[model samples]
Target: MAEQINLDKDDLITFFIHHLDKVYSAKSHLLKRLPEILYQVHFSDLEEAIFETIKVVELQRKRMAAIYELMGALKNEGSISGLTGLIDDSFEEIKTHQDNPELRDMSILFYMTNIEATEIASFQVLQLLAVKIRKERIKELIKENYNEAKADKALMLLITTKYLSTV
Candidate 1:
């Protein structure tokens, strides 16, 4: 019996912007930290995969900027995401496996998959919000980004299996 708050498309847009900020923040953090992680990877294939991921992240960031521009919303500079903790944990794993290149590679791959998984989940939510807002172009961008994240996650899984099979 509590009073109901009537929300409209403007409110939906506001919520959508908040989610976009979360992803923007995550990509920013990844762009900064991923290179350092890349430096720690010794496997040639893993190295190449990580490099590709960095490029894709850059692409997604551009797409995000375009989306923000289209929506007339400023990217929230102070937003932080759940990815911060996952990346931090990956760093810890690197430190723990410092002297062991193979173990470090394993840790790196594991964390990379986790990061992609996080992005995929976030993008799914964004996709849902974009659909709810009924913006076809925005929905298309969201879908593109979502599909890219899904592909990256799948590649990570494939590489993980490849890496483990040798052991």
Candidate 2:
């Protein structure tokens, strides 16, 4: 069972800002982890894809910073506990597959796809908030971030199905 919560306009705005903070935190956390994950990945194309995505992630972080500036909510601190927990779980999963390169690569790809999904969902929510608040530039920025996440997900799927095929 679950309880329903009600929020006024101001509360909604605050909640939105909090989520933006969490998105920023998630990006920051990924930036820190990507290099370590990249080192473990053996495929050249997948490695290149991750290297390119690092640049995109940096840009997304800057865009989030701009949004915070726009909303005058730069000081807000938020928890990205879900993303952090996912990353922690991924590390444990990677450890279990260390003796097998194929399994490790597959694990990493699946983990990245999950991360991309989370980023896409987060950006979508941000886009909705931007529209509701009439922040056209912010909405556009969030859309671009969402598109990058989708592309990253597609790349992971392609690598998993095409390059890593066991058949």
Candidate 3:
């Protein structure tokens, strides 16, 4: 079976927005509780990194929203062509962290968000570049990754709850 992408930006945005919206909600909740988790960790200089990360996320959210309106316009349509930049920007956001486990976890979360973005965008690419790409293969891959993330999320929630209770 071949999936054809006729350049429907509204559809693409809707697809991406569904995943991104969930991530934004989860991150917003986590951000509100970050202070409690990091009370013992130094955040003086890291405030800038947090600020930059927030800005990028905000911008990315807006971009996902604007993608619909951007579809039919010439200048705004350029946004679709700049998908690589969005991916690269996401990668750059995580590059600020070193080897710290907590930071690594945060970076991985950021990467996961980008993965959602790319997975949605890649649909069009797959349609164009590799129409024969097996749907089952992609579905299986996504399911495996999703299951791992779900397990990790559950463990994190348990640990965080315990830590908060002790605080």
Candidate 4:
């Protein structure tokens, strides 16, 4: 995992893009298994929960799309290198935003807080793939250029509040 990344914002963005692609691929593979799970499970409640989770995945896909937009904006402006420098110069920016537990909680709640909240089978698959991608991305950052502390900080930001459990 540590072998795959360069320690720069552009590199990080590229790594995440690739990682997301892998995740999407893995999820596509897992989608085939969903029908089996859907069949064997007798509980209608569980079925609904699984359906809701799939909806959440769709929402997450949109979020990733937005992230890609930001990535594109950075690239189009020729700011990727500058952005990397900014990230390196002000590591505290990401940290300060993440340190507020209330903000973090609210953000997560805002995303998933809805009627009929239940455990979704699709979440397990998404969670596993997301974790793997994050782990690999961070490991790559750690190995190539950044100091241990900076690499660790980058990992923390990647996990953020939303992905902490998986991280």
TM-score of model 1 vs. true structure: 0.91
The parts of candidate 1 lying over 4 Å away from their true place are 1-7, 79-81
Number of the top-ranking candidate, with lDDT as the measure: 1
Task: Residues 1-167, candidate 1: write the lDDT tens digits.
Answer: 89986769899999999878878888888888888878778787899898999999999999999999999999985444366667777777777988999999988888888888888899898888888888889889988999999998898889889988988
Local accuracy of candidate 4 as per-residue lDDT tens digits, 1-167: 46784466556556556544443333333233334333333334344544544554454444445544644522122232322333223322323435564443333222222111211222333334434545453333223212322333333334344344433
Q: Who is ahead in TM-score, 2 or 4?
A: 2
The reply for model 2, stretches above 4 Å from the true place, is 1-7, 75-77
Ranking by lDDT: 1, 2, 3, 4
Q: Rank the candidates by TM-score, best first.
A: 1, 2, 4, 3
Which prediction has more favorable lDDT, 3 or 4?
A: 3
Candidate with best TM-score: 1
In model 1, what lDDT does residue 117 have?
Answer: 87
Q: Rate the local accuracy (lDDT) of all candidates.
A: 0.85, 0.81, 0.41, 0.37
Model 3, stretches more than 4 Å misplaced?
Answer: 1-17, 24-43, 71-167
lDDT of 2 by residue, 1-167 (tens): 89996656677678788888777887888888888778777777778888888999999888888877887876454454777667767767877988887788888888888888888898898888878777798898889899999999999888888765653
lDDT of 3 at 110: 50
